[model samples]
Target: MTDTCVVVPTIREWECVRDYVANAREYGHLDRLFFVLVTEDFCDTDGMREMLEEEGVEGRVFDGEAREQWYEARGIEEYGDLIPAASHAETSFGLLYLWAHERFDFGVFIDDDTLPHDTDYFGQHYRNLEHTGETLAVESDERWVNVLYRNVEEHGLYPRGYPYSAMDEEVGETTEQVDHVVASQGLWTNVPDLDAVRILMDGDLQGQAQTRTTREDYGEDFVAATGNYLTVCSMNLAFRREVVPAFYQLPMDDNPWDVGRFDDIWSGVFLKRAADLMGHHVYNGTPLCEHNKAPRSTFGDLNNEVPALELNEHVWHIADDAGEDAESYAEAFGAMADALVADDTDYINDEFLTFVGEHMNRWLNCLDAIETGEPLAEPTPADD
Candidate 1:
């Protein structure tokens, strides 16, 4: 059975769950829709779960505490602990941890604030996966799939983690250099993921503005994105289950960086490089989503810009260098982790390595448990 899983990590964004799932159903039936809400000690988990149940949406709601419990039970408390104490960070790890255990053939990740604008949003992602597989099998090594992200309400507005510096307008690279991409991202409307600095600097559109790149103009086509301009967000992206490993959110650090910042930037960079190494391609697709973002804290967003500027300049190089081995995606992932650790910058630290090691080990164990019908090792319960 083909199971499609969508994972949404939220802290207080509970209000939108019902509507998000409602729009999801318009595209296809989901096998499991996970809403992992992070709270202190898994507090109010039942309340939250009941709230979603009241909405009549079919999904499981687990808390941060339940995640810790799962990790301890699996004898990987250290690995789980490596996930930062921040709720946003915990939320990211919780989603990946669930993927490590769950069974599914396809997966989609969307931020709670993002809503599907088209009925075919889910189907388009799945179709791209199919196209990606066929392209890789029969087409060529250079072909890969990456969804497009078209931002609404603003022409130059891009997502927070987007490598706007690498836009084709500046690089002038043709599609031939970067062809056949499978994993792509869709764009958003209503406060598209642009930087605060740019927004303030431009001082344009206090409320709303017309967005660029509609499906009616471009149609449902998987256009080849220039190699220089590839970036994606958890806001609205999908991938095959096999590529889930590549989408693992990088561990958040205790440094000065703001919470929930730069994680997707790292993911986008790493996934693109991993796909390239595996002979898969990535793109920016045409399916659009409306991102009704909440009001922003200007100060926090400004602080986030510091790391964004540094990383946007160099992260891709790290990914590009790591993928030089041309190893399989799984092998390249470990290699990439090792490279990230070797760099040992404040962003990529000892804790991130531990997280990576545990994740890699768990992935193998997960496969073993499924193949041999043997359960994974767990911590011994204390005597009552």
Candidate 2:
């Protein structure tokens, strides 16, 4: 049996955690799985720990203080500082800690609001990551695969961060099979991961009745062709431990810019670029999760997404150009960061780009610190 851990970052109450534990116990491989819950300062960590203990769930809840201690003990305290206290991207810290400490064979990520479908959720993810059998190899002429098309019955719907310009491009599919699956992205049954604009357009603004979108069965799982990229949602995602180095979810909150909500999408961009260069495969499908999305102001989400819209159009292309000459995931990531820093774009200013690029390199340094078991050297101040 492969060692697996589920990483969840949540600000919700204990009942949310309790439901996930129950779902895992009932539909997942509970015995083979461990849970790493990263909670906000407001959460009751003690109560959460007690609930896990009473439920016989092998898990630990990390509040802000505990996470700081974990990073400090590993000598990667600087990396911990990069993650904001109340952001969704804080899950990146949990993932790094798992890689550097627990060393699980596989890591699965899910949102606190999602529940596993009645099927064998963890088993399917494990099988996909393990590449148990042959699966379809697909590519798009547009260079981007809208995975939403495969998972949902609805037409004209795209996942968050999908390039608006590429929606009309032609798709070329292949029946070839590949065995190098390193990542598996499970689909969601209810309240699929759509952008705020889409949510508003579909619901209140358009005056349409709200509805849930369920996963449509697409016989067999498929992997992206060597050159194609897929939009990866951190929720319902599973990847082998080897990819963790290149899989740092980009931080969106607490930056000196207006951008937010592109963390996982951009992370996927870099991961896919690196995976393509390294001869690994990313699988899409199976192990559907029921996403009972929590209520939030759609207008606020729209505001957060506004600045990212333009960045989304160009970042994937930038990653592609930067990664073409790279030989490894780390190298590809480094190249991408350099490209971002060098880019002259009208939408994203130089100051924000420099900040983002600096953090990208900082993430790499964190991984190096873990591998070398040494503290990261202080970054030199830039000449003004």
Candidate 3:
């Protein structure tokens, strides 16, 4: 079908999955588009089937681990000479279509955390896919969101863009130039542009560490529209369906390449790299996001005589103790993750074996990293 496919890849975010599918339903292209939840089968799966059928969505369980791992192994072969290390899930999402591109046409891969800001723009994305068939990435027109990419280069663990000097207490600069931006709500149309995307994911960038964008104290002034490395992010990268079968074959894991890139950052690198080469393209719709909740205020450092860049509306994150600031505390909430996965007592044997094997594999990888790659044993595992 030369129609649009809204694929929301979710994990434990059941409460939000239906709403995301519903957002795609809002688009007039409901018939022309398919909204699916590519997720693991949860215990509460009983109502999903009827709910999806009732809502006009196609719910499918992706072999999350298989999809991620298969692609990694293939990537190990395809780009082995270059990738040396396997790309994580983020870098791996671009490969999801590795074995299934023939089934659909245009596609938008959104995460469970994001939803279309409004229906008008959501519909516009479908139209863009129908028209250009090019990757459609979203970038908010607001200055705060735009300024977050301050300094296109000198990025550290965060903002990994331009020179750090570019950032001050004030908003950096504005070019009026808006290509596909890679942020929290990516918009892509990967049809004929599949190969380019594969190369992009191979580049370096991130999203899970997005809170770091705020941490870096980056503003627009530091951002310089230069080359591929400067390509924003895929918070909202959409592609044509034909592109999937080519890249979706990778194996999923805590760390695919065995290298330590966060899942979101790995995906961001892929889109950023591709756009670096593909000439700039603007999305047709307005911002899919209006006001991104800022959990805490930013350190405007304005008193230094520099203006305090108002980071209104854009997503902001802050460091806080348990319950003092947020509900999604990784440390505090980690127990829930354990609880969620723990309920599966039936797989005790399999789970235990997998755990032992995984640890052994990590120790071996560590040996390999030291013997081969320069930085040996630096990147620690997530749970570690």
Candidate 4:
């Protein structure tokens, strides 16, 4: 009757995972959605499971040591010393273990750090998945950025382009929203049984995301599977179990993985390459888990960020471009924008160097405006 499942991976995410499961159950589709948590630290498995059961939400936790074996099988023992603590890749690998060895039609991958502030978030994904595609997620207002394409390699953006395929040749007409949807926070559907997951497990990182994708054999419909850029914050992402492959441990024997930051980015790159071969679309539609405690990314800087972000949760009626319209805020995204446009670098490492936290909140704000005409605008001083 139901086609979607909720997959939460845990390492030290006991608290977050507990909150995520409870929120998912409150959404009304808990019966249809399977909740599975993979723990990297097996010792915590029983505690995490007990915690879930105590909360009236049932879940399954896979072996933590087996996860390590998955890595050894792939030759990643070298990075035993370097994998960053609490990195997306590390958390992701735990989730990947669940995906590779599990059975499901569609799976939603949500990070353990977030606690859904609203229950409707998951219900939306349930509806979107029924429509079409392997992935669906929130827009994050990624389309608004003019320089999005430039940061593809740097951000690991993906076969991810905005405005959603301007031309639709199926009937010689383009659609309004988008066909290439990347499901985060839950949609995760439309995987062709064994398509996205079957052959990709039990290999190195490249093998799980790269080699397996390119090396696989699919009908002309898909050559490989790709993931979302901003949608894949390692916090909330949902996809048909098959639309994406289960992740493999970093091949430490071949090369040590820094796992410092960019693991999820690299995951996007691998999936994008696969999707590109098949000529499929990737997008965001379903709402994922958001950090109510945090506003922006710790690794981001604010530039061209509408400036009035802190004043209001929504923005509308912006009546100026640059110049005095832009106040003197040193941490503004404009600095990053300048580096992106003026310099010869794909990433904006402006000499002005400012700290950008909550990197996607700015984009999420833009998306909220489009979804609801809520007033997200900041008024300019008429006297000035």
Compute each candidate's TM-score over C-alphas.
0.74, 0.90, 0.44, 0.46
User: What C-alpha lDDT do the candidate models reach, one value each?
Assistant: 0.54, 0.76, 0.32, 0.36
Worst 10 residues of 3 by lDDT: 311-320
Determine which window of 10 residues in candidate 4 has minimal summed lDDT.
Answer: 311-320
| Candidate closer to the true structure by TM-score (higher is better), 3 or 4 | 4
Which candidate achieves the best lDDT against the true structure? 2
Query: Evaluated with TM-score, which candidate comes out highest?
Result: 2
Global lDDT for candidate 4? 0.36
Q: Rank the candidates by TM-score, best first.
A: 2, 1, 4, 3
Residue-wise C-alpha lDDT for candidate 4, range 1-384, written one tens digit per residue: 444556665565557765665666676666666566655553576676677677765455544455445445444444233222333344444433333344455666675545665547666655554445433221223222111222223422222111222111111112333344333322111111111121123222221122211102211111112222221334555555544331221111112211122344324433333333333444442453443222233222122121212211111011011112322221122322233233332222221111111221232232223234432222211110
lDDT of 4 at 76: 47
CA RMSD for every model? 6.1, 5.5, 17.9, 20.9
Residue 60, candidate 2: alpha-carbon lDDT: 74
Query: TM-score of the candidate numbered 3?
Result: 0.44
Candidate 2 or 1, higher lDDT: 2
Candidate 1 TM-score, true structure as reference: 0.74
In order, how many clashes per candidate? 29, 0, 79, 36
Where does candidate 2 stray beyond 4 Å?
13-28, 132-134, 151-155, 205-211, 217-219, 374-384
**Residue lDDT tens for model 3, 1-384:** 335555555554445555555665565455655544444434334454456666665444333443344334333323221111222233333323312333455666555454455455456554444333223222332212232333334432222222222223232232434443322233221110111112133341211222222223321122223232222333354554322312121222332222221223222322332233333232322234322322221111112101111210110111011123222212222222233223333331224323322332332232233234332221111211
